[model samples]
Target: MTDTTAFDWRSFLLNWSGEWADSLPGGETRSEGDEDARRARWLGFPPASEERIAAAEERLGRRMPPSYREFLKVSDGWRHAGGFVWLLAGTEDAHWHDNESGLADMFEEHLDEDAGPEERQEADIWRRGLQLDVESDITHVLMDPEDVDENGEWAVYTWASWRAAPPERHADFLAFMRDMYREFHSLRAHRRDGEPEFANDTTRKLDAQVAQARSAALRGDWERAGKELDEAKGYGRPRAAGLGDQIRRLLGQTYMVYFEGLVTDPRYAPELLPPLVAEHAAHSYRDDSTLTFHLRGAGEDLVSLAYATLERVRAGTYRYTAAGPFGTAVERARELARWGGTDEAWRTLIDALPLWEPLGPDHLAPLGWVADPVLGPLLTPERGRELLSTPRGGRTGEAPRPTAGLDPGGLAWLAEPDPGDNPTSYRFVLVEGAAPEELPERLADGNGGGDGDGTVLNERLTLWEARRRLLHGRREFSSYDDRALVAVGRAGSGWSFAFDGDPAAFDRRRFVSPAASASAGSDTRAVVVWSGLRARHGEPFFHLSVARGGAEQYAFTYADEEVRSRGRIPQALDPSRFFGDGEDGAEAERSLLEAVAGEFGVRLPRHAIVNGRLHTFTTRSWTRPPGDGETYAVIHLRGEADRPADDDRTADDDRTADDGQGSR
Candidate 1:
């Protein structure tokens, strides 16, 4: 028998058998020898006599490692060491690896002159190592006698062909066996078969550890919880694996977590399932890392049921039946969904998540509802962003809404311009004391100028035609070259107008404000206004920024019914008053434009912008910096630039001129 004070081999074997029984299905009786062997694999064979061990040692001319000998005193051999390894050899079967398999010849033949000392040592060790595994699936367990330590324990290695990795080394046979036991647990954790009840003391001890870890996690002692769960997991407890994953996710170490085993009890399913389903659906297609549910057994069926229920919720045919805060929240969400207020309903559910409590120790409560059956299908992807867009405990107060309006003054034309197919998305940069002809140069210098040979072309076209040409350039050459086009002209007496049709251009507050500041001449003021009639998601947006003396003075943006402002916004141009209380998004946007135009004393003649000609230039404002080992090529497509003679100067020519000027 093994010394209980050291390693209790009998108890370890018993725990291993219990875990094996819990994982694998039972009741199939095989023929005599096969059945006996299979039974012995789990329960283990009787301990070998001292005389038998001595006879085997005399035959092999080497004494067995202390741990291996002690293990033999408990059980002669082991079986199913892990997923890959099969039967471990007993005294009667153990032999030298090289003598039996002759694989040392293959290792020597492949050994290179440049092989490192460690590699050479590994190859030589394999040649004389004692084999511990008598049967395996392309796997071998070896003990190196020459690598004995002070304790007289030989170094052990587990090599598998399918791994394509070097042999995994362990300090001794005991350590190898312990790792194998842990591997068995990890592999079995994913099984679809039922987990049988483990009545063993070791299992009870591990389960208790997991329970304590859960309590610790709830008390916010996450570090302690993680350590405890990690320890329990080492003993092959599936509950520990599940709880550890949850702790990792809660601590922000990972974005995904998983639950194993069957979860069909109605008491627990409601509290446990929604978050897992939602998180799984949310990150299913994520590119960075694989996030999965890890659901097995009846858990799979439960997920399928949840999906069906979600479809019913979307169809307005499902009703939550349970009582309590969560059920009430669900009902509220259902009512909102029925009334076409899905986003509001989703918010209602999300707000109530913190109040959710677990029904059992195994359940993790208050997960996101983005994938909940009753709310997930109703929540649009755009709205679902609310689930993780902000840090936990960081959100407070109601979202900002547009409640103010700005007076149009002399710039009323901006609020009511010619509408049909007019460039709805555009930006205007107006610099005082900068002539119309010099506006392009100022902007080119402010932004990082392009890189190409000097070639400048001046053309005049209506704002509509200019926008079309810019869009055409974007579609045609965007694959090889990043480019944009801007129409420059005199807006009023002292303001030079630079307009871009791309809505996203100068959309970023930092970029637009800095660009405006850079465009201002010494002691001169510059103003930039960006307006988008309808974004890709159908939301209108407006932004205004003012710069003076080579620095930005004020900036404001109003989008998605929210306002963001920085610096000292003039009271006359306060975005809160830029829109009337009853105004829709489009009207609000127009009102904001009028307010900006009036504040900056900027006015663009409608007739000139709509029909008259204006000087247009191509800019490389959107070109991305080249990555490592990356080069760019410019290809001018034939028949694509077939515009009027006045529009002959392509974006490429202006980029080359800008590049030349920037170089100087």
Candidate 2:
């Protein structure tokens, strides 16, 4: 049943032969110099070079079969004188056997013809070998010292030898290798279309399972169908954990069919229509170059589907796997349905699914174990009721009253109450005297319900208003006459605090260092710098400078390198942790106050850190128990004194501070 001409021993021997013995098909094992052995040696069947075989065996870490070495003597070429013999073992083509002279001629001819191409081919061969070493290489086998029996010695188990075993063993080895190769294959096949079939058994199996699932569904076994489909999805099949996608497509159609039946007969249970409606409403997406798609919709769909699928199984229409998505979906859906969808229920769901946690590399949908994106909105009784109500009148509907627990005035004064009793409105409050036109462009757009054109003006206006109120009642003076003077506010951005001396005209102007220009993306929040001091004339000095550039750029600047270096000002501040989409603007404004306080050695009760891309801060209002004391003090790295007593040797100020009691 086999073709002899198809077997090219010369190429086969050079390529697939892992063992030297396997390279020698048939050869005699007679003792050296024996007449019978010499004759066999001349026929291409000769005993192997004992020394070479033993050394090769030692290096290879495996025993050589005797039959292989025996076949190599006459085949060695230089030893056999005249026409010789060529023998092959089981399954080898017998016609390849020929006169030894002809075999030798063929070998020499190939060597002469292939020299140049062989060199180029060898480079490619080496490259291929290196790749193979990376992919599915057994060199990683480590003999675990702890797993050794009794003694401290370890055993070298051979994955290769096991892999090369007979068909039955190969099947077992395939299973082991499949798991072992998962990571390697993932890298090679990541987002790569057209992967070879042999390397992608997982995907193949999943496709087959999808087919099987559809078949099961057609036979009216909804649970069996859903379970099979879920298994294909659970192992991260069809590129990432693709459960939602399959369920949506399969169950969407299934539920639609059920809906047709329900609408026709009111007794058909309106309960099932919700799941069908939810699935249809959810978003659906397909990844580039992938057969799988996701039902990317609101998490409410997950609850509906999970509940419906579970109820169907409970009602004896479907069967399921205990640990799969269908199983968990069922359990969760039942809980939400039974509890009447409370805040506690949504909280439990959140405890299971945290926001932004990825499901899988290729999966866009978060696993059911995690919470949904619109979790906060979903907690509302109105939304919850819409998601949980059954079609028929099994559960009663008694809506609760609004404003159930607080005085009308108190409720009005408090920022929106924690989401309870169906509260769902958001509002913003502006600081007093805040300019109506200088707000940050984005804020203006967000507040005025317009594009971001005039938001920056609005933001600046607010800052001016707050600063004007804060600076009120402060002392001011004229140059010659003892006339009462005022510091008027104007439009513009940056540090604008007033001081006894003209800070704007101070010599040694601070310029933006080029190095500071390197970072340009961190401009979310403005950094405030303020200085308060007392001069020898007994006049209080105050200065303020606000950085308007991006936080990515360096924050501080001074004319003297020594001054800038010694001050220890932070070069950049990431505002991500301070503010988020939720909550009132109080938190961000409070953070702005703290940054200003830190530069002036003013003690404050709050601290702020940017965490998870939000500009969040700890403030007096944020403290668990409101108090009057400054729990945390903000101090400049360099204290309020312009210069240390020992270091104050300035050309102009040397005589004034000699007594070491400089003005406070």
Candidate 3:
């Protein structure tokens, strides 16, 4: 029950005509080059005459609602992008069941099958419907007059042909309009945290470039505008698209490859434009906003759209739509990728960050998709796992692992060997009752005697809790100063070794990108780490550690991000990626080498693994080394195929942990 009087038709119309859509809801139908021309070139049909409006109502055997009827009188039909419509048919074109572009036709096709009892009852009359014209081919806006009552307002329902479930129901047209308005802004804005700021010089340069693009578009200069768009898109900002869209709308020429041999291979004996892709033609435009990748124009628009996704993803401001055409403009850029060839494909895969939805699953996940030559080469299956999983998991596990197969759409990964032990799962002990120097080599099985000082309790933990502690840090250990993290894993098939070190030394996230190796083939094996090492580079590899509290003792591991999050890690995620995390190939090599040895051993890499925060304790402080001495010495694990014999190191280097981090 919306208060109709509260409607701001003026505001709605002003926003609707935004740089496109040529009147319609933003204003009555207006042609391009009119007094107040903006970016869009599409036009709206002439308003319905009184007789025509009455005839439409008479044909339907029901009086038109006042508001909707008034709207139609302003513009009978429209061809536009942005405000939830691609084509708003006039009364003559409206139909109850025409497959090509009929709203009622779509409704019947997905009606009862995807509707609940109430919804089905409402659709039985087939009152009215409109297509949303999003990236996906099958979705629509429907109105049920049966339940309208004398108030003349009808509840609106959205039908997505891709959905096998009930259509989404909104209270009425106003509600639906509100939702579309929000989507419109979001599509244009992308990130809500505000436009990314540039440094003084970059800002001035980009601002100038954007103004030039705008100026060129205003004067109808497509060529100059495009070059400006090219330069601006290279930087992180949304303005580039807005400006380019303006120029594109002004040009008014879209070359659909199917209709025109634009990208056809001249190399082919019978050269022809690539085969038609009419399957998703519905995705070409937004009712009121300008289109990217629309009509197979210059693929640069798709490139800009894709790159924008990366900026938002890295900045931690991405949000998937509540109702997806299933895929986003960024996701749809894959088509643009193919249309534009290898370069466009590469650009889209990198910045678009295509997602995977396992068959039967409606939601998309960032990782676990099988390797695309471009995507696979660029990312690991676990690369953006944390960013994609919704509702987010706890920070209590060892780290997330690739839970599926390479072909994201296929179920082959399910048939593969379970990677066995997860790296994130750990059973460690944080000794609160003992000083850092007083704990035994085996804290879990300790005799329980140490130079007591401030150590007040012994907290043994499941790996999940251990992970939580690593992510959370010493917040819970504030009352007691000394703590030891005994991160555990099996080193060899025959013998298991525990990493006796400080929690401060273990960080799953590091500045150095671990060189990601090739993905694991079907034959790849999962090896256990008795907690002595993290794979080289980005991994939380293991090493022996010793910290000073009252006494000098070994500690285990923890995760730290490059940015200090204070606990909220996502906000601290790297704004720009520093790639490379030790890969599937490294794990395979380690497994093969271990199998070849067929013996018990553990070894250390050349890097020092210990990390800590320095505390300025008094000269007499028990945790400090009696005087102005540095923290305790960090030893190296003595075994495990020592390829680099000099790999081991002592804390003599005096290095420490960086601020923020992540999981697989």
Q: Tens digits of per-residue lDDT for model 2 on 1-664? A: 2222233433433221221222132443533533343433232232346675566546534433222233332132111111111122211111111221232243344354446743333222222111101112222122212222232222211223235531111112122223333422333333334433323445566667766654443333435656775565443344222333323433223332322212222221133333333333332231122111222322554445545643443232332212333335435643432212223333443233212222222222122221221111223333232222211112123322221111121112222222332112211111112222222321221222121232232111112232343335523211111110111111113211111111212222322221111112244233222221211222222222332233322233222212233233353322333334552333433353345444333221000000000111100110111122212111213346534333313323323322211111
Cα lDDT listed for each candidate: 0.60, 0.27, 0.34
Mark the 10 consecutive residues where model 2 has the least summed lDDT: 605-614
TM-score of each: 0.47, 0.21, 0.29
Best by lDDT: 1
Candidates ranked, most accurate by TM-score first: 1, 3, 2
Q: In terms of TM-score, which candidate is strongest?
A: 1
Candidate 3 has an lDDT of: 0.34
lDDT of 1 by residue, 453-555 (tens): 1123245555565556545633233222334466666556677776665544333322334345445567888887767645444567777778887888888
lDDT of 3 by residue, 541-581 (tens): 32112222323222222233222212222211221122125
CA shift of 598, model 3, Å: 54
506 Cα displacement, candidate 3 (Å) = 35
